[model samples]
Target: MFFAGDIGGTKVNLALCEVHDGRITTQFLRRYSSAQFGSLSDVLVRYVKEIGPLSGKIEGTCFGVPGPVLNGRCHTVNLPWTPDSAEIARDLAQVVEAGPVQLINDLEATAYGIGLLQKSGQGLSILRAATGAIGHRANQALLAPGTGLGEAMLLWDGIRHVISPSEGGHADFGPQDEEQIELLRWLWPRHKHVSWEHVASGPALHRLYRFLKETGRETEPAELAEALAQPGVDASPVIAAMAIRGQYPICVRAFDLWLFFVGAEAGNLALKSLSLGGIFIGGGIIPNVLELFRRPAFFAGLDSKGRMSSVVAGMPVYGIVDPLTALYGAAFSAAHSHGVLHGFR
Candidate 1:
């Protein structure tokens, strides 16, 4: 059995996978609220207790965290927890004599997961561009927007793709039009350093909703207002649902702007990576509001690069609909580490 996890700020996904002849099958999977746990070890302990003992049956384990990982340790960016692979390995040794416990940046894991999916020809749903257009030796780029935006690149070396993590999500937010300039000015004073993540992530959706209401550009409907005002309520989902139903103009507008920013950042990543292979869009938000991405405004944002418009236009684009990509990646990496899966080195 291989242990794998996708550790994020909002939730933590853990799974036990079985690998046979390079094929991975999940034997057990569970998701826990990250905020409810004090540390990653606590969650792991609970998971091990919940599942029956596997003593010495585990071969290896891998975890993907949303932050920079160095020397098997990482202080997660969005969570109040620090995860160390050495400590985790030692702790799990009591339950199972597991092999090396590996920790990797979440985006790096996602890129690996994408490559694994492409190779297996299973559990991958393509939303755009022609299938199989991404050549085996071509470079690939990944852009995802969740609690925060994530960026990564897969550099193809004759036989395999190398994962490269990026902090490009924190890069400056560039305005494309006068209205965006005004919006930047509005956000500037509140945040001294405005980034694309500030205007494109899940929290950005709430920020946009609040901005429109405060600026008197749009009025929140009574029902939506009440829903947002509820205790412990998250307005992003409600707003997205309203927009999808076309029941609220403000929600629709906010969703549209969100897609525009996302598309622009995706295009920027494509240019920087020269990802003629393809640009894969993956995130919790993309699958929910995918229809909006097909709108003309989104394509306009993606194709708006001044002289490089032609270059980006020819590049294939795709949306990853599978939510378990990170989990799959963590499992694949663990299997590869043990030589159970080949051709990924």
Candidate 2:
């Protein structure tokens, strides 16, 4: 059996996986609140104890961290602690006795898992059909917006794909319209640098709602406002749920802006990577709101690219429907990469 984890800003998914019939699959899985634990090791130790009877059975271990990993270390932008793979290996030596712990970017793990998922022909939906041809394999990209945005590229060098992790999500935020231009201006004072992440991620949903409400563009409902103001409540989900139900106009507007940003950034990634193979949307949000994402407003921002409109609008788009893709990928990478993979900058 192999151990794997999908570590994110909001939560951590840990699992024990085994390869059966030439396919890697999880046997035991659990999710933990990331903020509750001080370190990755804390969660691992707890998981080790809770799973029970798996002592020293884990052959290899890998984690998909939310930040860039360099030389087996990562300084997480969203989480508080920095994790070192070598140290983690030592900490878990008594429990699993596995090899060195491999730390890969979450997007890298997702990319690897996406390749595996594509082969199975399951848990993937084509949000936008390819305008030209069906099986064009040249280049591909992934745009994931969750606690933060993630970007990656799959370079098909005439043979197999090479997964490349990127921090393109941190790149500058360029407005596509006058309304978005005003949104940028509103955000400039609050953030040192308002990247696409500031407007596109799970957390950004609340910020968008606040912007719309505070700017007098929309009126906030009294009861909903009270619920949002209550401490410890996550407004992002509340707004998203309302938008999904088509209830409140304010929530609908924020959701619309979120989709527009997703589209713009997805198009930007496609252009930068020349991802003709396809563009895959993976993340916490899009999968849950697939129907909402299929609307024209989302494609409007994507197809708005001035000169290269046709190039981008024609590329196929897919949503990763499986939630455990990164967890599966971590295990898959560990199994195939000999516990290590390159391109961690």
lDDT of each: 0.84, 0.87
Question: What's the lDDT of the predicted structure labeled candidate 2?
Answer: 0.87
For candidate 1, the per-residue lDDT at 339 reads 81
On the 0 to 100 scale, the lDDT of residue 214 in model 2 is 91
Could you give candidate 2's per-residue lDDT for residues 1-345 as a string of tens digits?
788999999999999888665577787699999999999998998898788776446668899999999999988999997989988998887666666589999999999888778878887899988877646467898999999999999888766788899999999999867888899999999997999999988999999999999999999999989988899999999999999998899999999989889889999999999888899999977777999889887898777789999999889999999999899789888877663333211
lDDT of 1 by residue, 221-275 (tens): 8888888999998889889889889889999888888878888998999899888
TM-score list, all predictions: 0.95, 0.95
Off by over 4 Å in 1: 130-136
Candidate 2: stretches off by over 4 Å:
134-136, 339-345
Q: What is the overall TM-score of model 2 with all chains considered together?
A: 0.95
Positional deviation of 156 in candidate 1, in angstroms?
1.6
